[model samples]
Each structure stands twice: as C-alpha cells, then as structure tokens.
Target: MTHPIDSTEFASLLCSRLCHDLLSPVGALNNGLELMADETDPDMRQRCLDLLADSARTSANKLKFFRLAFGSAGGFGDAVPTHEARVAIEGMFAQTGRVKVGWMVGDDMLNKLAVKVLLNLSLIAGDALVRGGQLDVGAEKRPGVTEIVVRAEGPKLVLDPELRAALAGALPPEGLASRTAAAWMVRSLVTGRGGEIVLSAPGEPMLLFGASIPG
Candidate 1:
C-alpha cells in the first residue's frame, strides 16, 4: 500500500537529504580555502589548491545530478534529452572512482517524470555498492509505457531495509526520513502514474530495481 505524504513535509525531507549529501565536499572546499590562506609552504599551498579543485569538481557533479533527480533541470519541457541524464550519471560516479556506469538507454529523450525516476533509482543502486562496483542503467519506451532498470553488482553491496521498503511503497509516511526520501520519491512517481516497481531478493548477489509506468 502507498502511504500519502504531505507535500510540505516531503519537500523538507528532500532538502535535508540534499544538504547532507553536499555537506562533506562543501565543507572540504571551505577548509581548503582556510588552509591555503594560512599556509606558507608552496607545496602545502599547492596541495590545498588540489584539494579545492577536487572538492569543487565533486560539488559540481553532485549538484548536476541532483538538479535532474530532485529539481527542475531540463527547464519547462515535458521531455529531457537522454544524453543529459547519461552525462549526469557518469559525472556522479566519476567522483567516487569506485563505480563504473554502463548506460544502455536507447531512447533519445524521456519524459521528465521518467528521467526523475531513472536518476533516483540509479542513485539508490549506486549507493548500495559499498565496496565499489559496476552499475548498469537502462530504459526503454514501448507502446504506452516506459520501463527503467538499474542493476548494481560488487564485492560488497548493502541496500538498507528502510530504503527497500520505501522503494516498494511499503514504508509508512510517519517513518519517512531524509535518507529514504529519494526512494520514496521514486515510489511516488511510479505509483502516481499507475505504475509498479520491482526489486531483487534480499540475498541476491546483485541488487536490481525495475519500474514500469504508463505514459
């Protein structure tokens, strides 16, 4: 069963999740600036500059990904170019240097809602690869429906029960939190369109998520 969440509360949870994800890199950027200001050695100063550069890159990548996943990224259009989403996903995992993304989306464009669901599910699957892994993202449009599939495989994969529950639309509204906001959003988006989500078994060697929504 799908539990209804208030719009205002859901927005708050998303905001909190965004802030939490960006905090570490943003804080590193600030610290790097402070260190550069006080450092006298050229090598140390150079190191600080390098830190700043990496932090800036990470922050930018995350913002780009989140813009598409959680915000209005493709402007006011009803459809967004699939390449943009491909780039966003690549940039997102590039920062970690631990996960490789394989994009198999054949469509040139996807509806805005489909883009959001794809990105969010990809985000969840990528995060499940605790010890770094391969993430495969694919989507297809057929007849009157859009289908999305995300797969994660690694030596160590961990998908939290709460997130799984949220994705399955079995988590209660009162139990919602920032960590599960994206999963819940994916659920809401799919179900709102009279769609359904599928998940691999808990003990499976790989983590998989699939969604089919009527367009």
Candidate 2:
C-alpha cells in the first residue's frame, strides 16, 4: 500500500528543527547577560560560568534529542527505534527542562513518521503541563500494518490556543513561538501522514483518535 503523506521535505523540515534548537542557546545567552550585569566579583563571575556551562550542556543535549525527534534522526526510509523515541523524550525533559517524563507505553520500532509524530505529541502534552507534571505516554500498532497510535497523558493540561490553532493549521503560530513550533511540528508530521487529528482539551483526560497512522 502507498502512503498519502508518507514523506517529509528535508529542507523545510530543517527550518522547523533549527527553530527548536536555537531557543535554548538564545535563552542561555539572555540568562548569561543577566548574570553579567548582576555580579562584579570574580567569584560571582565563576558562578556565572558554571551556570552558563550548565545551560549550554542542557541546550546541547536538548538539541541532540530534538534533532532525533523533530529533525532527521535517521534517513527518511528507515524505521526509527521506539526505544530511541522514548529516550529522546526523557532526554528532552531531563536535560532541557524540569518535566518528569513517565512512559506507560511499551516499545517497538516505529517508522520515521511515527517517531516524529510521537515526539511532537509528547512535546504538546508536556507543554500543556508546564508547571512540572507527570507525562504518561503510550502507543499501539495498527492490525498487521505499518500504522501506529501514540498518546500523551497529564493532569491540569495547558493547551495553548495558538498551539491548538497551529495544530489545525488555521493560522501560523507566530505568537506562541515555542508552543507554535511544537504545534507545527506535530500537525505537520500528523498531516504529512495524510491523517486527521482528534484533540481533547484541558478539561478532558483522553485525546482520542489524535491521528490515524498510515499503512
């Protein structure tokens, strides 16, 4: 069987990916600038150095994870490792921010489309609970097909309007930049799969039929 939206354009996708990685460094620079202004003593500068180093490392690790998640971890033709996807999610949270990512879903090798789809959805769920909430992720495969299902769980979900809008592709997510990027990433991956998005809300527990995987 042929897939409808089975491929991603690397050049355009690369832009999406670069958008995600640049944030950490830009944010770190802002923090570093603040540090530079606040302290005059050498010891204080050293402290700043440590902070900078930590932030840089955090950014680097996050970049690696995002590259695997949003960028091209493997070639377009290759199946992405499900374990790698899970690890990338964990790594994103553990290194980039403070979210504690918990996996409820078992692992299996997923195609590139599935990896990117799950990755973006996980980010959306994590964003919904920005105040450090637990992330529950799960997955299932279509009956004897290459299709797959993925999900994210959390309490007190914070669904950004722009993110949602971008998910629908109703408007470009220029305002809620990061959230927008996430929205675009997920929507693009899911849409690129020629699938539909089934979204629940902040008040809802389960986001059903979020997307239909292609065969």
Where model 1 places Cα greater than 4 Å from the true spot, the runs are none
Error of 1 at 82 (Å): 0.9
lDDT of 2 by residue, 19-65 (tens): 66677676886798798898999999998888888777767667777
lDDT of every model, 2 decimals:
0.94, 0.64
Q: Per-prediction RMSD in angstroms?
A: 0.8, 5.3
Model 2 RMSD vs true structure = 5.3
lDDT of 1 by residue, 57-145 (tens): 99999999999999998889899999999999999984578999999999999999999999999999999998999999999999999
- Candidate 1 pairs with clashing backbones: none
Task: State the displacement of the C-alpha of residue 132, model 1, in Å, after optimal TM-score superposition.
Answer: 0.4
Top of the candidates by lDDT:
1
TM-score of each: 0.98, 0.69
